[model samples]
Target: MLQLVDFIARNRFFLVFVLLEIFSGWLIVRSNSYWGATYFNTSNYYVAKTLAFSNSAREYTRLGEINSDLANENARLNALVATLSQKNAKDAPVGYVPDSAFNARFTYKVAKVVDNETNRTNNYITIDKGSADGIEPDMGVISATGVVGKVRFCSKNYSIVTSILHPQFMVSSKLIRSNEIGTAKWPGKDPNFVDMVDVSRYTKVYKGDSAVTSNVNAVFPPGIMVGKVKSVTVHPDQTFYNIVLELATDFRNLSYVYVVKNRQLGEQETLKQRLGDRR
Candidate 1:
């Protein structure tokens, strides 16, 4: 206490000067409109800047949560769009429907690709949805841009996807211009390219031809984009066309995907079995 008193006594002259300076400034601002206006303007400027900084800080902290919410909303909208598209396709006249049966074969459920890989030979992806979310094995997966892959396995909260880059992945795809369908396969060479085989050379295929799911095998819905023709070559001795397709989706950057579920899958399977039994 005695030390504190001595310190204060020592600094009393400086403290008094500081207080006097503050009082003089206040008096000048209060008595003069010009000074008051100047002071107010400076104060207001600092206050506005501080408030803006504070608000920005708060918003920055909330960015992740906001992004997640937005992604979920986007997924919901995609699901609604898929549903509506399916309904419209089904309502069309039966005679108008294509004979391929791929156009109306599957339904879609939206999911986010929480984890993805592309550089490996057997690349796989993990989605933030599972069987509990109506995902199932063999369900076709796609994004807004194009087809992704199919669900391989699922748990309650997550699922593993067999990426289109996987060697085991095979999709029934066809040229949009010529309607020449073939088996789409990945040769483990490029993540951006897939091989479309069994297409006859006489199909009139060329570079830049759009390819889509054939839906003939009922694995994926027809019209789901597979890729575009990047190159076409006829095998020396074979009658088939060796076509290279450039995938529409950037596999390394996949963020969101939709798992296609055929609501009538069970009925379709049962009918197939019955037909086989009769045969």
Candidate 2:
């Protein structure tokens, strides 16, 4: 306390000068109309700007929550579309369903990506969902843009995805224009490119042709986007075309994904198993 008093005493003149300066400025602003107006205007501008900055910061902080809500809403809309299309198909005349009446076998659940890896041969992604969220092994995972992966394993609250970037990950896909079917696979080399194999060499394929999931696959719903043709090559004595595809999902930028839940999958599997048993 003594030291503080001594310090204040030593700086008393300087402190007095600062107080006088503040008082003089206040007097000028109060007495002069121009000064008062200018001071208030400047202070108001700063106050408005500060309030705006605070509001922006608050909104920015809520972006994740906003995005999660949007993703969930999108999932709900997708489910609704699937349900409507199914209803339309059932109501349509046999062998004459409209294109819009064709429905897929899958519904969706939104999940936020928690981890992702694209560089490894067996790359995987993790999401903030699992059995508790109805996610299971073999459930197809997709983003807003396109296919992402399939569920490989899961805990009660988290699931791991076998990414399309993984060498073992393969999906039945077809050329949208030509309807040429092929198997899309990653060759353990490039994350941006996947290889579409088993497409007949004679099939007409073009650059930028979209590849989408085929109905033959039980895991993914038919017509879900897979990728686009980046390049095509023909080899001597080879019956299949060597094709490179620009992947639909950008693994590097993955944030949220939808896990496909095929409601009839269990029934379908049981029937298939019974048929095999009879055979």
Which is the leading candidate under TM-score?
A: 2
In model 1, which residue pairs have backbone atoms overlapping below 3 Å? 102-215, 102-222
lDDT of 2 by residue, 162-271 (tens): 99998888999989888899999999998999999999988799999999888687777666789999999998999999999999888899999999988778888999
Give me the runs in candidate 1 sitting further than 4 Å from their true place: 1-56, 87-107, 217-219, 235-238
Model 2 clash pairs are none
- State the displacement of the C-alpha of residue 253, model 1, in Å, after optimal TM-score superposition: 2.6
Off by over 4 Å in 2: 1-12, 31-33, 81-105
Tens digits of lDDT, candidate 1, 1-279? 999999999999999999999999999999999999999999999999999999999999998788667766765665565455555664367666443333344556667789998989998999999867877888888887788988888999999999999999999997888878898889999999999999998769979999988747555666778899999988679899889999988888787787877766777889999999999
Give candidate 2's whole-model lDDT: 0.88
- Model 1, poorest ten-residue lDDT window? 97-106
Least accurate 10 contiguous residues by lDDT in model 2:
96-105
lDDT (CA) per prediction: 0.82, 0.88
Per-candidate TM-scores read 0.73, 0.81
Predicted structure 1, TM vs. truth: 0.73
